[model samples]
Target: MSIMTQLEFELEFSQSEKQIAKYILNHGEEVLSMSVKELAKETYTSPATIVRLCKKIGLEGYNDFKIKYSAELQYDLHHTDRIDVNFPFSKDDSYPMICHKLSSLYQEVIADTIKLIDFTELNKIVDLLYPHQHIDIYGSGNSLLAAMSFQHKMMRISRDVNLRILHGEQVFMSYNSNSSRIAMIISYSGETNENIQIAQTLKENNTPIIVLTSVGDNRLSHYADYILNIGSREKIFTKIAPFASQISIEYLFNVIFSCIFQKDYEQNIQNKISYDKKNDFRHPLSSPVSDEIK
Candidate 1:
């Protein structure tokens, strides 16, 4: 089922069934090949309950339901490992199948990116970040690691202005707004309601908002004055968007950084020198530097 269709039906599942539904929805990678008993244990429901839930969701049996849902989620994750490595009985024709589909996916990514990007809107966004005293990035889960990687890159090239806010206090620290100027919220789905609220609150407080999100039509995207789109199909996960979107977001961020550096050729060199010097903290490892200096 498509993500929207699954969400629609899942919303109707009874309280007990909802747990099973939510587990499969959120943990698609783990659930894709799980046995009925395994799924039941993971969902904290009995095998009988898993069967009942599958029937209610309009599947013939547990295997039938699992197969359909598994295929959909696997397609969303861009994982063809199992299919490519089929059993001895299976034919080798799948090599061509895999090649054709993955190549198509790549072209789709390029086309979708081009269609979604608005140059005028993007230029407006650059203007906002261009003048910021500092740029604070907010993300959690798998995204937090990506945010930190981006922060490391910017800090290395642009000195102290980039922050990767992982813990509690540092995230809310921007509210003071005494030094830092802008905030970028990185979430594959704009539906990360907490991240959305952060952007909303920042807007309320007069801090500009820049969003990196996969869903172009989401509620949070509507509020965002500047958006960098990550065009991954959000089918494998429910509590958040798909992980494949990371490729797109990282690609966009690198572009933004390159643009900034390109525009300020001389300052890019100066900033690099300053940031390098700032990061080079010295301590005596083998000798007393004070005595040597004297």
Candidate 2:
């Protein structure tokens, strides 16, 4: 988790710790230049209290906390253009203005999402998934749609990815899952009851879980062996649409698919090409104007 997110969402801090966290969050860039004692004095706390706050959030000390927090602050300053994820445009906006605003929203959300990605964790997920012939996915609503898209892409590469639409069927699948199978659960809020139930079932069976969720501490994250975060700028109930979450989820799935494909690049390419030739039924007019691959 990013330091900014951890500071914002972590619930175990005491009153003095919360005060220190609030001070750092409000004056992020300025804190980079100050010593631990200086920060403690400013927050009206002792240096030991500040260090304890840093360690509580998983940092080694104040300096380590500052380094990570400073990077996040800089990234936010550069990439976040104040695009409102909940309402990117107003009702009276022109079509052209709407187009531009939506486009900018997509760009900014993707940029913010990229900052949350940990390549080491992603590589571990790919390694765990690559050796499995079958995988199960669980989600609801829009998140389900994203999972279905990933299922389709993996199927094209000869992987059996299962998705059950019905709640009972999903529960049944989860109960039957074993350590041999890997399951991925997608929940934006990470608090969906059905998703939590499925995650629990999988956990009892010793199945490794991969979670795709928004950045913050949540229920679903507890069961996950690996987590991939989506852009988390949107409000759950107030958004006009799930524009940011949808795009971020799709982008993460695409990156996963592409990375897995690259693991056996030549063989996968040949397999796709061979499948295309065998399945081709298009007329000459329907073919590409310049067919270089053929």
Candidate 3:
């Protein structure tokens, strides 16, 4: 997990630990150069307390924590061009600057997502997405939009997929879906009650479920047959758009779709070819004489 992820998962942290976390989150790059004693002094806590905080978050010690933070910080500094998710662009920014920031934001979101992906689990989900299996995807709002995108991709390759954007539709789909069917839920918060209800219904029906959510366990993760996490560092104020989380989810979904696409690449190509030929009549071509008259 990234240091930022650890900080976000601090629901059980002590007051001193939270204080240290807040400082480190604000000045992660600066933390890289500070010693344990320095951090303890700055956070107004003991050195032992700092080390304990590091261990609580899965780091070995303060030094180990610093190393991880420094490495991630360096990667972000070098690769992302410093696009702040909280303040991606300003009104006064020029077109070129906006372009640069947006581009960098996309790259950073995808990069962070890639770091969190578990290839083994991803392959398992891909295997389940074979042409024979029916996939029912459920989500709300923007997550539903992402599900529609995946549904479109699956359609192009002739895979069976149902996208349920409404709560009633999702429940109905889950109720009718058989054990052979698979369910994929896309929710960054993973706390959507309706989505969770759909997942539960599917589970009761013996349907396998794969969840794409932000890092850290949540109520939804408990029932998933397979869980996939995405990078999310956007703040509450930045809720103007769930940009980072949505991009992360879409990026991971693309990876899974590509894996499934490759599994039947030759067959899929042939199917496309046949489909195009069969649909050719639907797109009528005008004759040269008709064009000349026009």
Candidate with top TM-score is 2
lDDT of 2 by residue, 1-294 (tens): 456655665447889888888898788799999999999899999999999988877679988888878777777687566788879999999999999999998888889788999999999999998989899989888877888888888988888999999758999999999999999998887777888999999999999999999876678899999999998866566569989889899889988888988999999998987887677556364567624444
Order candidates by lDDT, high to low.
2, 3, 1
Task: Residues 213-237, candidate 3: write the lDDT tens digits.
Answer: 8765567888898988978676533
Cα lDDT computed for each candidate against the true fold: 0.63, 0.85, 0.78
Off by over 4 Å in 1: 1-111, 159-167, 178-180, 236-243, 266-294
Per-residue lDDT of 109 in model 2: 83
Q: In model 2, what are the clashing residue pairs, if there are any?
A: none
lDDT winner between 1 and 3, please give it: 3
What lDDT tens digits, residue by residue, belong to model 1 across residues 84-157? 21121134548777576555555555555666677887788777666664887776676666666666766655
Candidate 2 positional error at 255, Å: 1.0
Prediction-by-prediction clash tally: 0, 0, 0
Question: What TM-score would you give candidate 2 relative to the actual structure?
Answer: 0.72
Q: What is the lDDT of residue 25 in candidate 3?
A: 82
Return the TM-score for each candidate structure.
0.56, 0.72, 0.69
- TM-score of candidate 1 versus the correct structure, residues matched by position: 0.56
